[model samples]
Structures are given as structure tokens and as C-alpha cells.
Target: MANTSGNAYGLTALCPIINGHTNDSNPLYKAAGESHDKEVRRILQALPLNQESPFANTDNTYLARLFILNDVFFQQGNDFKRDQLKSKYLCFNSNFHGELEPYLTSLWNNNENQVREIWQHCVAFESVSNANDFVRYIKSCQLTTTLFFNGSNDQPVAEQLKALYVKQMFSEFVLTQQGKSAAELKQAFKYFLQRVQLNDVKSPSWKPGQTEVAL
Candidate 1:
């Protein structure tokens, strides 16, 4: 499947938004007359970005985004007939490492409330009551990926983050320890290794979606 290129998976889903306005009294929506598409977009926009993104909690998620597609674009210089969608769709695209099941499971497990809030406006999402249901619903909405671009090595996210941490720390060590005595340099290198704990990928490493290094 095009969705699987090595250990990476690209997920593309277009879930139809409900045709009517939400009747729920949630403050996130304008109960009087807000369209479902508008509510979905509002929820997505209010979501935290970067390290605080819901995907940041989802294991192995390299990238993900969401948007509302109200209609199709007309191309070919207006010679060809323009097409229009019957309904608006909540478009979701994700690029991640490892199998789709586990990745989606992690997403549902880690960000269930956010997922429910955003996807509730989409048709049939009410059937998603748990992780398995969420996975199944997403699969039903999934489109076959015709082409998936793999830009990085197919390594587990933890390993990749650890490698980056090692590189940065080693570079800093090289710069700061310059011109030290041989013994001092050797001792400093040992401390650096101990601090980095290169054998452990879980700690002293970059967090997923982290933008700025913590002081």
C-alpha cells in the first residue's frame, strides 16, 4: 500500500462535515447558528501548536495537519468543466513512523478529548466511543495514498530524537572544551557521555514537536 513506505505511513482522510449547525450548547460553538464546518475550523485553530500540539503526545507522529475543504478548485484554464463537492470535508493529513494502527491508537489514547471535540462535527463520528472505534472510523474516512514521500530515514522517533540530542551535545562539547589539557579534555568527555546517556533514548533528548530548547 502507498500508505506504507518502509516503516513510515502517510494517512490522508476526508471526513464529511455535518450539513447542519450544532445544537449543542458548548461555548466552543455559537449554538444559535454556527455551521459545523465553522465549528470544526474553530476547534482546529484553537489547538496548541508545536510542542503543545495534540500530535506531540501521539507517539511517532512526524507531522500532521487539519483543514476544512469547502469545494474543489477549477483548473485547466476553464476549458474543462469545474467540479464542486456536495459537502464540506474535514481534511486530515499525517506523516508518521511505524504502523498505522499503533500510531492511531496512540493518538486516540493521548488526545481523546481533543479528537472528540474536533471530529464531533463530522458525520458518523458519534460512533467513535473509544480508541478502536476511533481507529475504525478514521480508516473508513481514509483515502488511498497514491504517493507517499519519505524524506527521512525510517527510524523510530525516539531514536531520531536521541541522535539529534547527541549531535547537539557533542558539538557543544567540542567547542567549549577546545585547548584544554589532554587529561582535562578526557575527563570532560566522560562527563558529557554520562550526562547525555547515549544508551537511553527516552531522557536527556529532544521532545517531539519541541521548538525551543529548555534552559
Candidate 2:
């Protein structure tokens, strides 16, 4: 795979072709740790090409973050640290235990497609001008809602849901009270907390915050 050098972006200009072998006694392919790391790095670097930017493409960013998190999880020698990292990063079975290049490529492509779907279905995302707005848009979108509930529990959908809620709250404070000081922001947050009740439905009960806050 490393026979050809990568471009300036650390991505290969041409994907290497692996010929199928008909031999029954051929040894199974095993990826070296170093090779896996290199492939992960390459994929992360190329992720931006799949979209305008990481911030504009949450699904792609999500996949890139997963690769980084999984890499960190693998590098730790301590068992306890590894376990902790695993709990946080390795939520879903991505079927990444096989070949390195193909698996990483598949992940990047799949995320790219998912981001496209999100953009197509979620019109609110187009009007997002800031991080907070982006979060609110994602929270209000049905695509994210479906993914949050029907999607795999092992995935980072739960983390995404939490992030959306937090961003939505922060954005609400900023949008409604434009000239508020830090003290005012804090007070608003406290007031919001007192009035907001997280019921069994997990939905917040404010004007705009009353959207479906799923996990």
C-alpha cells in the first residue's frame, strides 16, 4: 500500500489495487499497528476533501473524531486507561477489525454519504451561521432525531445529542439577550434550569428549545 507516495495532503493520488488470489492456502491479511496508524492519519487528513470543512460537516467530523479516539484507545498500555477510553470511544461495532485501508476508506465514504443526506433533508442546517446555530439546527432536524433513536446505541449518536442540547441552550442565551453580561448569562442559565424539566420524553419545554431532544 505504501509503494506509492501520498500527495501534499497526505492522500494517495491513486488508490492501490489489490488483486484477488485464488490460492486456497494463502495466508490471511493482518494489519501492522504502524500501518493502521498511518492509514488512520491519511483518512483524517483527507476528510476535509469530503466536505467544505469539519465544522460544516458534523457526520464527517464525527467519523474523524472516532478514528482519533480509537487510535488513542489502542496506544494506551495501561489496562485501566484502555478500558476507560474504550467505554468512551468504542461505542459501536464499525466492523473495523479487518483490513486497514479498505475499512478506513469505507468509513470515510459512508460518513460523506451520511453528511450529504443530512444536508439534503435538513433545511435548517443551511441557515446555520455559528456553532450554536448549527447545534440548534441539528437538534431540530428529523434526520438527527431518527439517527439518535433508531441508530446504533454503540455509536456516538448519544454524544451528538448531548452536544446539540448544550449548544442549543448556549445559543438561546446569546440570541435572546444580545447585550447580556457574563453575570446575566449565568443567571439566565440558572433560570432556564429551574424552569426546564427533563421529563421521560427527554424534550425541553421552552419556546424554541421545545424541539425533540432525543438521545
Candidate 3:
């Protein structure tokens, strides 16, 4: 089984910058320096898409793992340790990469160009407005794949992806609102939860699991 616990630091660092969440004083922004484009390329290289096309075989586990990793990276403090992060990534690869290979090979065998556009969008997601936009994109891709491939198993897959997205978004939102008083933060978080619940009502598939979003 693939280990889905590892975080995607590359996306976490890049997305906030792209969405204007980070500033010059931020360590992540400083790390990118003047060559932000180069840094993006380097990060993409570090976390490449599956060897095969993303649209063909239809296993979203790898994609989900990427989002999970990105969330972890986003939540890291200014005192982030490169050595520790590297060790975690190594463990993630060892545990999950092998398991994901067979599915990727099947996807590649089925179509070389399938889902290429979505893959490009994912890698070049800096233009995305925020975490919500990013999550919606993933949900859309999962839904599109389901419709195109006529797969019944993908609904749950898409839900899982949305759940992860929400979890990360909430975490990031809370981080940004650090100035809020405890009561204010709590109220804001409750309101956010209500919004998420309403969204889920509109589209049940987007509903996260009970424990997915914590206070």
C-alpha cells in the first residue's frame, strides 16, 4: 500500500507565493530569491508527475499524496529544517513510490497524451488564486476523468481529494488569521465549516470525512 502521510513541500511553498499569501519577509519567499521561475522548475523536478499520463489508468492515490505533501509544507514554520524534510521525503518515496509505479505504467501504456493538459495545469498552478481554487481544480479533474473513463470507483476518489484540499485550505486560512482573538478565530472557523457543509450539500461528493477537518 502507498503511504500517504508525507507532505508536498514544493507545492505548499509555491502556491502561497503565487496566491500572494507570502511576502518578501517570508522565509519561503526569500528562499525563492529572484529566480522564482527557476525555483518552480526545481520544485517540479523534485516532485514530478507520474511517469505515465494521469488520465488513463485512473488511480488518484498519487495525486492525493501530492496534495497532502503540499499541505504539510504550507504549514511549516520559518524554522523549517532542510535535512529533516529531506529525510521525510526519502521515507515517503520508499514507502509509496514503488506501489504507485504499476498503476503509472498502466496509465502510460493506455495513452501517452491523455490528461496532459491537466498535468500541465497542475505543475504550472501558480496562477491559481488560492487553496480553494486549487482544490476545485483537482475535484474537476477527478470528475472529468470519471465522466470520460466511465469509472464508478472515482467518486470516492474525488471525495478523498476534496477532503484533503479542504483540510489544507482550512489550515492555511487559520495560519493567515493569526491575529484574530481566540473567540474570533473560533467563530471564523465555525463559519468556514458552515460554508464547507453548504458546499457539500450542493455537491455531496465534495463532503469531507468526519475527522478530515479539525479545529
Candidate 4:
């Protein structure tokens, strides 16, 4: 119940980053002075954005992000003791539809290479060889989502995408069909319904992470 609010799942994980330099033999580690955490950040920054993002291919993923956690901030003039993290961490948070296991499986299956590259610097991540392994690894690093915000109404991503597609197509139809004859308007309306495919959520629907209108 901690990570679930209806059908939506909010996942948060803090995978401990290794406190070591990148292996010299690795092609990605061109600089001998680069740390594991720095290389992870560089790769994250180079990831494709918007429609081309890795999460775009990940099924049911509404949103996902990754970043390195270097340290906790100090509250100035506070009397409480300061917190010092034992190691830098890789922070991953994702909002998605369906169960955690399924979503994690989709994530690993779709972006295995990217996942391996980013999480290789994290502790115990080398053991993650498949979807099940990835799920277990994530759970080990998972933190309870105490206060998840349900901004997506717990709807499956396919349904939401279809809704967006229908709305866009209908709006365009309304604008373009102005001043048509009654018979012509009726014909156009039939075509609009066919094109929108109100019952079919797969075809002619908005692509996940789409940023522009294609229809």
C-alpha cells in the first residue's frame, strides 16, 4: 500500500554509488581522473529528451528520472546534528501505471543497455542480469513512497493517450468542418469517429511522450 494509490505506482530508489574511479579499460572512461559518480551524471545528461527518451519506450511509464545524490544539505544556524552520507547514491523516481514488477520488467526489457550503463556504478547492481534480477535490485534500494501525489487519475497510459488523441482530432475536425452542409457534416462526423477509433486504444493514439501533433 505504501507505493500504490489505486492503480498508479510511485517508485523511489536510492542505489548506493560505488566510491571508486571508473575502470581504465572501459571505452566510456576516457579520462583517468573521472569518478564513477561523474560518469553516471554525464551519461544521464546525454540521454535523449521528450519523445525520444528511454522511458518513452518503457510501457506504461508516465514519467521517470535519474540523478546522483552527492550529499544532504545543511540547514544553516540549526542546532541539530548534520547528516553525512556514507556514499554517493543514484536516485531514481518513476510514476507509472500497473504493478511494480510489471513496470520494472518493461523498463529493463526496453532499455537494458542504458539501465546497465547507469546502474553499473551502483552497489550490487552487477548481479542484475535480467528483468527479475532488475526488479529485485530495485526493491532492495526502494524507499517507501509515504506521500504519493496522484496527478494522473490512476488511468492506464494507453487510455490517457487515446483520450488525448481523440480530443486533438475532434478539435481539429470541429474547426475544419465549419460551414459544411448538413449531409456533408454528418459524413465528416462519421469519418472522424472512424479515424479516432474511440474503442481502439492502440492505433491513431498519441504516442507516449509525444510533444507534437502528428494527426
lDDT of each: 0.90, 0.35, 0.38, 0.90
Instruction: Order candidates by lDDT, high to low.
Output: 1, 4, 3, 2
Q: How do the residues 1-215 of candidate 3 rate in per-residue lDDT, one tens digit apiece?
A: 21223321111112221322223366875665533333333444554344332331343333323321222344457876543222111001111122234444443444434323223323444444443444443333331111122222334344555666677667787787899999998898887776666356233333322233333
lDDT, model 1 = 0.90
Comparing candidate 1 with candidate 3, which one achieves the higher lDDT? Answer: 1
**Per-residue lDDT for 1-215 in model 2, tens only?**
22111210111111111122212232442322223233333444665542344332223123223233332434546554443322112111121122334433443354445433223222233464444443343334212111222222323333444445656665775689778888987888788665443331234422221245432
- Among residues 3 or more apart in sequence or in different chains, the pairs in candidate 3 whose N, CA or C atoms overlap within 3 Å are 7-69, 8-69, 8-70
- Global lDDT for candidate 4? 0.90
Candidate 3 segments whose C-alpha is farther than 4 A from its true place? 1-156, 198-215
Weakest lDDT window of 10 consecutive positions for candidate 3: 87-96
State every prediction's TM-score relative to the real structure: 0.93, 0.21, 0.25, 0.93
Clash pairs detected, candidate 1: none
Error of 3 at 124 (Å): 39
Kindly report which residue stretches of model 2 are placed more than 4 angstroms away from their true locations once superposed: 1-155, 193-215
The C-alpha RMSD of each candidate to the native structure, in angstroms, is: 1.9, 19.2, 18.4, 1.8
Query: Between which residue pairs do clashes occur in model 4?
Result: none
Query: Number of clashing pairs, model 4?
Result: 0
Comparing 3 with 4 on TM-score, the higher-scoring candidate is 4
Candidate 1 lDDT over residue span 17-91, tens digit each? 999888877766664578989889989999999989999999998889999999998887847998989899999
Reference-based lDDT, residue 57, model 2: 29
* Candidate 3 TM-score, C-alpha based: 0.25
Off by over 4 Å in 4: 26-32
